[model samples]
Target: MDMKLSGATFRRAASTVTVIGGSGFIGRNLHRALRSVGARPHVFTRRKPFAHAGRVHPAVAKSDTIFYVAGSVTPALAERNPELVEEDHWNLNLLLWGLRETGHRPLVVLASSGGTVYDPDAAPPYREDSPTRPVAAYGAAKLAQEHALAAADWTTPVILRFANVYGPGQTASAGYGVIPHWIRAVHARETLTMIGASRRDYVHIDDATAALLAVRAHADRLRATPGPTTLNIGSGAPTSLDELHRHLERAVGGPVEVRREPARSFDRTDTWLDVSAAGAALGWSPAIGLAEGLAGTLAATRHTSMSP
Candidate 1:
């Protein structure tokens, strides 16, 4: 999807925007995109940990919108160390308190997880109104943040339950992005590891960023709505491990090695999203298909590997 937003539209949407956790994967990309479109973006990293409300108050005081992308742990990591979950909640409360102290009720957009925040046994293609039964600590933490935002009447909350988002610049971290990890493994001629027969709905980073911009552009309507707006952001298509392997091989122009492992206790068998509401609400839909996105990511991975 195109990253450029019309100047007139941005002017109408917001002037000063604050991105918490601006150094992370999604936040970094969103920060760059916001700059490209001529919005004044203020970034607050986790380096300081937002310990003092005085420090965060100024950053969000006059902002028209705030994107909360801050979180300490992934699902797998959170499972190992559940203490991080409490820390995550505390950090958000600090941000909320800062906003309250400043008396600024900006449109707050939260980056939530669609993969972990749904009932695993309910059904596939979970919707915004679907029952939330987070099996892991990470999912529970995200849901807690959602509840916090919903309870904060001063701010307009827009919770985006994002499916697995992968694209260029995503690092090959453990328990993070399978696509990037597999692509890196292919480049290095290493074995691609598969866990069980899990399937996931992957959305491109461009599409994810576009969805955030769409929320920003629709800030007025969202604020005018009765309550907090929660929407799913994903491709709405599930791809199994075998299917992803085929696509990756095609993208790289060769076959790669593979190794299968037993599924972890925390892993869900399948996860897809029903993104129709996000489409209807924000006029947004996933533009990059899995194959196309994989190919682009492969090219990027190759370039990055060769870079000095």
Candidate 2:
């Protein structure tokens, strides 16, 4: 919604950072923010990973930070296709091995899923110490990814379990990103489908980027913190599907038709994260309100649709 850094700039610990999926929603936003702060981020995508290095072996060379934001599928997709989910796990392991082979001891920041990485039976405001009982393949994969990173003793791992992060650069396709999907539908003057009554804690993209940077800035401090530290990045405010619809209506300046459907087995109800750990650890807290974030998203969507 605003400039990521917002005038207060700090020196980066690393000269260059490596983003595994630099072109994706979060990755792209983080990449832009890092550039604004005068840091070089070597982005690795499937098409252009080793273009400059000539091979995969040297791709991670000289990078001081590795931000792992790439993933293969949505939660629903992963649930329907366990084979593909397993394939993604193996692929992530291969990338980890490659990083190890390069002998680069970078601070590894894994972008975990806060939405699916916990037990549905657990109470609201999920803490870092909460038990993880993933009901979907996507959450299982994220938990597995966190474990895989932990096993790599050569690197320092910092996991950020992000909540429902939505903003301008998000997409409605691929059966995920509900907020952006609904915004896109509203922008097109189409009916908004509501599948089950569920509540989620949404963190704006600007706040998400700020949290990532805070982790990078406080890398050493987090490493010194006793146990396997994983902070939940969320707004700490739970918004129900109905409330979200009202926000969308206000953002779009009209009432959108709603078609209610049965809740899917993969969806969680009344889930939000306890952001205290992040505030305590990284000195970060979400500043944008739900209404403001939704308006910003709608404006960005309109700008994109009218472009070109």
TM-score of each: 0.96, 0.92
Q: Which of the numbered candidates is closest to the native, going by highest TM-score? A: 1
For candidate 1, which ten residues in a row score worst on lDDT? Answer: 48-57
lDDT of 2: 0.81
Backbone N/Cα/C clashes per model: 0, 0
* Top lDDT prediction, candidate number: 1
Candidate 2: minimum summed lDDT over ten consecutive residues — where? 50-59
Q: After superposition, how far is residue 88 of candidate 1 from its true place, in Å?
A: 1.1
lDDT of each: 0.87, 0.81
Model 2 Cα lDDT, one tens digit per residue, 119-168? 98889889988889998778988999989988877677888999999998
Task: Put down candidate 1 lDDT per residue, 1-308, tens digits, no spaces.
Answer: 35656554556544778898888889999988887777768888877454463356565767888999988788788899878888888888777777775565689899999999999988989999889999988898999999999888889999999999999999888778788789888888899998889889999999999999889888888989988999999999999999999999899888888999999888889999999999999989999999999999999889989999
Q: Cα deviation in Å at residue 308, candidate 1?
A: 1.8
Flag clash pairs in model 1.
none
